[model samples]
Target: MAKSNQTKSKEETGASRGRKGDRADEIVTAAFEEFTVKGYAGTRLEDVAARAKVSKGLPYLYFKTKEELFKAVVRSVLTPAFDEMRDLMLASDLPSEDFLKGPFLAFLQDLVKSRRMLIARLLISEGHKHPELTRFYYDHVVSKGIAALRAFIDRGVERGELKPTGLHDFPQLLVAPALMAVIWRSLFEAHAHLDTDEFLKTHINLVADAITTGNRGHETS
Candidate 1:
């Protein structure tokens, strides 16, 4: 004589005062803004809900808590970007130095113009205080990116296309330029100027000269 649980769930979803007009995505976007601007500890669910134009309780129905929303915001901002990086890394047949240092740097350039840099700054500024979020970002973005570079470096060394250096074993060294750009742009843009494209190219040439036995000259596109 009781309504089916599935039907009850449907009814509840429909009856939810905040569910009808609210979407998880909108909340995540708003949370991205809040988390990057006010930071994870400072952002509130009600503020996110207000920004998303939903009921004050709407974000909870989707995120359960601010920490969950913070992770979601990070994922939303980063997942697609890195998924593109994964695709680019796999499909790139350019020289290893060119591939790893070229489009990858370009991707970081684009990210600086987006909210991703803010999120990166947010993580760096607060990561020590939030180990969980720190681990999530490291595992998902940092580790994955480093692994890809390591594999690419190994392949290049084996093929004799790139000089075999200890660099392959240390992937963090590979992307340091990109991370430095992010930090410099975020924290010191006014005090100093950085030409990101030029910096990336110069960095590549320096690394290439150190790690390549080839006769290839600087190939900036």
Candidate 2:
């Protein structure tokens, strides 16, 4: 009888934890929406709680400050996707061009489809004022991504698959178009439609051609 009672207690505890976890996710999702619509300085924890439809003190129970909440939003919305891309780059032995055209292109599409661009806009517009937040993002996310791209580029060059260019030192060249797409979508999409899919495909082909030795202007099929 005691063993059965203990088993029931453990099951109840697990369910309690699951409920709390779901509530935390709800708060994070609400926070992301608030931050997207209102810049960081304009957003308040009370407003986040209201948006979350939770008690006024509930957000405080989860995140002590606005900064913590903002970081949580970043982790929830951005970190996992970047982590997946980094892992994919690390594990794949495919040709550099193939990797860029396939997995990297997929990642850029996912980035555009998600709320990540709004987060990027936030970082670009307000990062100087919030040095701590900027550093946190760079240290936790940007640096890791850049390092992964650099490793892949270096490996390709060493194996004679890529040209002996400066790309290994500056991997930003690989994803520059995605950033451009963010800016264009934010500022110019109302005036003119930008076909993002074709844009990215062209970018991938151009980059593949540039990095592939003696393969200038060759289109990727």
RMSD of each: 5.2, 3.5
TM-score between candidate 1 and the true structure: 0.83
Residue 106 of model 1 has an lDDT of 75
Which stretches of model 1 miss by more than 4 angstroms? Answer: 1-22, 215-221
| Model 2 C-alpha lDDT per residue in residues 58-173, reported as the tens digit of each score | 99988999999999988988899899999999888677777888988988977875677799888888888999999989888899999998998887777677888888788888
> Against the true structure, whose TM-score is highest?
2
45-143 per-residue lDDT for model 1 (tens digits)? 999989989899989987897888887876888877887887777667777766656787677667666767788888889889999988988888888
Evaluate all candidate structures by whole-model CA lDDT and list the values in order.
Answer: 0.79, 0.86
Tell how far residue 73 is off in model 1, in angstroms: 1.2
